[model samples]
Target: MVRVHPAPLQARLPAFSTRLLLRGVFVLELATASWGGPPVQVPIGPSAP
Candidate 1:
């Protein structure tokens, strides 16, 4: 039998995917707020008027 080792990047994939998902949600929320769907106060980014 042969043994195999996981690459460094494979170990970090889960966390990277989670972060990507969260960022996608944030972008969607920002787009909706800009479209006047609802008031989502994003105090850290550019204000869309």
Candidate 2:
């Protein structure tokens, strides 16, 4: 047996936002290193098993 599903737009939006946020963070880091700004760290999580 198996199941099929389709992710809704609302669900997809968070994923899209997360990806964009990561890109933005990278740019922020570069700017901080070259231009100077407060550092920010978004921790991911603990080690996996």
The backbone clash count of each candidate, in order, is 0, 0
Estimate every model's Cα lDDT from 0 to 1.
0.83, 0.78
- Provide TM-scores for the models: 0.55, 0.52
**Residue-by-residue lDDT tens digits, candidate 1, 2-35:** 7666777798898999999999999998888788
**Candidate 1: where is the Cα deviation over 4 Å?**
1-4, 39-49
lDDT of 2 by residue, 1-49 (tens): 7764556877899999999999999998888876676554545567433
Best by lDDT: 1
